[model samples]
Target: MARKSLFITAIVAVMVLGFAVSAYAIGPVYITWNAGGANAGTGGPHQDYRLTTEKCAVCHSVHAAAVSNAAAGEFGPDPIGAAETQLLLRSSVADACTYCHITTNVSGLQIYNGVASNYTTDDQYGHNGSTSAECADCHAVHGADTFKGFIAGKILKAQGNLVSNVSGGVQTEAAATLNTLVSGGTVFTAPAASDGDYQVTAFCTRCHKTFSDASETTITAGGYFEEWDGSVTFGSRSYKNHPLKAAEATFVASGANYSGRVAWADAYTCRSCHAAGNNRVSTSYGGPGGLVSWSFPHWTNGNAQFLVSGWGVSDANIGLGTSGANTGKPSGSHTVMDGAEDGVCLRCHTNGSSGPPNNATAGVNVTF
Candidate 1:
């Protein structure tokens, strides 16, 4: 009986060892957002970073092609990588993101990095620029929801009042909250009442903090002016500024065209100008232009302002004034003063004047 038991134990040990070795050689499995098994039917809030065990291997190698660095939880001593150790497949964040985003996946949808042909122009590239931004700069790779609740899609790291205002090397402003945005949809609409402040606006302000300040004086107080929220008496002209944050009801009542503007979920957030390419379905401004068709705060026709397309020198008859619409042809000149009645502006305000609207103008100047 003892001899028989010893023989059975040896056979069982061999089988287990062989199975482990086979599993190790097979590489790692990749799971889609809606794959079968325990993770089937999982939604976006918890999809990318939660319960999806296979997803981790897609980006990271547990035992990378290098000596192990047990201290940093990564394979260490890799000459071509970072010291802190992310164990990324590619050396840098940009390369890894562009590897997938730059091309069309099996789904046939290009999310971040468009095809090379479509993104040929200077303004066509947003965060894809080599020096501009990386995927990790915005997105949370290993999952942002620490408390087992849905955060926003693309997993925005912070929301609500957690705006970043770093000045003189220290964060001068109050630290903004984290993960307050807990809603997701085709369009990033309003969240639950208890979620937080206007998340999209606050998220943008994390980098573009100048826009968050209420006063232009404070925004440009350093003597170098940044005309983000409209300027005050700079270079002999005053551009009519739009409100960055405000109640949608009040803004619509104050008169700027909200028709076909999708980002106006609850308030006039930063997304009003800087949003996804397809969000603007309005045909008012000679259909959507190429520059506007790309995501904002990234691609901008080399203009640096990141203003959407239709900003070119073309007259658009928006039926704003009692006078007939400008429609086609230059009713106004292309001089710097009038901005040639750019269609980008007309997309919102009725054609106010031959020149940029003054503070007295009711169409562009709506008080919150």
Candidate 2:
């Protein structure tokens, strides 16, 4: 009887684990964009494209694409003059992800540096790597599972023939080194199409944190290179990540805590809160004024608060977020999230300026 009971228990444990792993995440989890059999505007945010947690699985792994993987996502940029620059992405070597995520707020944000006149009709980004050179040619999302996510480092094609001849095929070598991000000299080499042995997370911290390597590899004026964590070992992203994770947030219901409370016309999507939500609004001079709707000061006085261990810095400079971190004041005075331990004050506000460390920092300093 004892042996039978033990066997039954073991089987039950396996079933439970499978359920956790296989069940669809109902909340702000990931939703992959699969073009396999999908049609445009068929499934996505606002009915733009069909969305499924499965599709997001293409680039990001299963439950793994949580707040912890901010680096895996694109670093949103706000190009000057362009409304997109106000808090949207301009452009990058990497393809824009908004194609399927489809929210007009980001889409409406001007990218291409006002070159809209050239491709005025539609967005210039997200062609699905179909051109002569595509996002995959120079970049990748689900890199060798070991490589973590996206092009965290530079890929050097040494083996495969750079130029493939029609008849006589030339096998070229493909290798990936850590690049300037982390491995100053370390090269994560890939022997074949599937061998991503030379990958490292440290390399990702470089651009993510807006700084160069400790050895000062590939420093540039355009990218945030100098602005890094104090320690070389911590790297740039690590620094930013720390402050962000350490930040706090309150998960208020807006009177509509979970169910029918939140508004449908008001604007909410899997991308909003599921993307760990943008913290910049909760932790900076400008509080949570989301693009979902025209609602300025979106956050509300939180009813629940939680302190995190990591420094909070979302993709782009967007910092930690509280679900309803509205600002009667700036993002500094977090009311319910962690009860005033809100670290967003560091973005702006300082001594004699406005909110502060207790609301302190070097980056943004508010005048009012």
Candidate 3:
């Protein structure tokens, strides 16, 4: 009887070992926001991070799903089947994001206030249009092939194809195709400390095509794009217009007189100058005026017209050295002024002994 018991124990051990090895071989499983948790069906305050499970029911169900296409409804039906788009619980990708992103309750990633203000009202604040903007339009919920910031598709391509891909034209390409066209186009699998500005520019160029063209020279229209490019050369010098991507690297390496107030290494992205709660914004911008709760780059406080407080060109406090206190709110227009100190142009470029080349007070102006 004892020998029989020992033999059974050995068999059981082998089965358990085999199961563990098989699980390890399968590798890490990725989950989404809506599935596999104690709070799965409870709704409203959704989880901030992804869960781990094989259940697609988080965002979809095999049967008894929602029937309505209403924006306020919890789920929308998939006509084809549950497998199609994974039987998405919402009508569309944008709706899924809105279900949680629109809120005044500070629990979830609140981008817009559903009760007070929303994306529909503040259309100019982000990538909104007559049609509701899709979150998947800009971000890949699962992952991207070449980009690391959860970018949805490829915006970087050969210089020849740059305009076509960005100007409301091609939009995105497959990872393999994108890699074949552009050098160093492989996805940055690892998370980097800084949001890649080069990639960020490509992302923005998808919609704002004319403003991102590097070859543009009109000074009135295409100049903004060129200025952001920072690599454009004129005569013998590479014009450092506000410094981005490699141009920023050159500036920082040159040991130019940076304010040392903002950490330039981390503040190189488009959001650095534009997002709410940025260090550059003055505290006097007022309550909830220049403040956005979510950290995502696409969202910002409605005030200051998307530009941080201290950086507005038309602020009543400009040149008064008052930091725009009680200066009212931003116009929400893209208008910029020449040689304006209150705007973002002077945050890094001041005449505080740094002198010319790096300092804008030496005659450089970013107004448009």
Global lDDT scores for all candidate models: 0.35, 0.26, 0.35
lDDT of 1 at 225: 31
**Lowest lDDT 10-residue stretch of candidate 1:** 319-328
TM-score result, candidate 1:
0.47
Instruction: List the candidates' TM-scores in order.
Output: 0.47, 0.22, 0.44
Residue 46 lDDT, candidate 3, scale 0-100: 24
Error of 2 at 317 (Å): 12
Q: Candidate 3's residue-wise lDDT over 1-368, tens digit each?
A: 99999999999999999998987653222223432244443222222234643334435544434454332323332232222232435434435545434542222234443432355544535444234345566554433232433222222222333334333332233222223323344323213322343355444544433321122222121211323333332221122233232123222324346423221222334443553322222111122223333223443444332454342222212221222323222332223322232445433333222323343322124211
Q: How well does model 1 score by local distance difference test?
A: 0.35
- All candidates in order of TM-score, best leading: 1, 3, 2
Collision pairs in model 1:
123-301, 126-298, 162-176, 162-177, 317-326, 317-327
List ranges where model 2 is wrong by over 4 Å.
1-98, 103-139, 143-318, 323-368
Query: Candidate 2, residues 139-180: lDDT per residue as tens digits?
Result: 333322223222223232222222121111111110121232
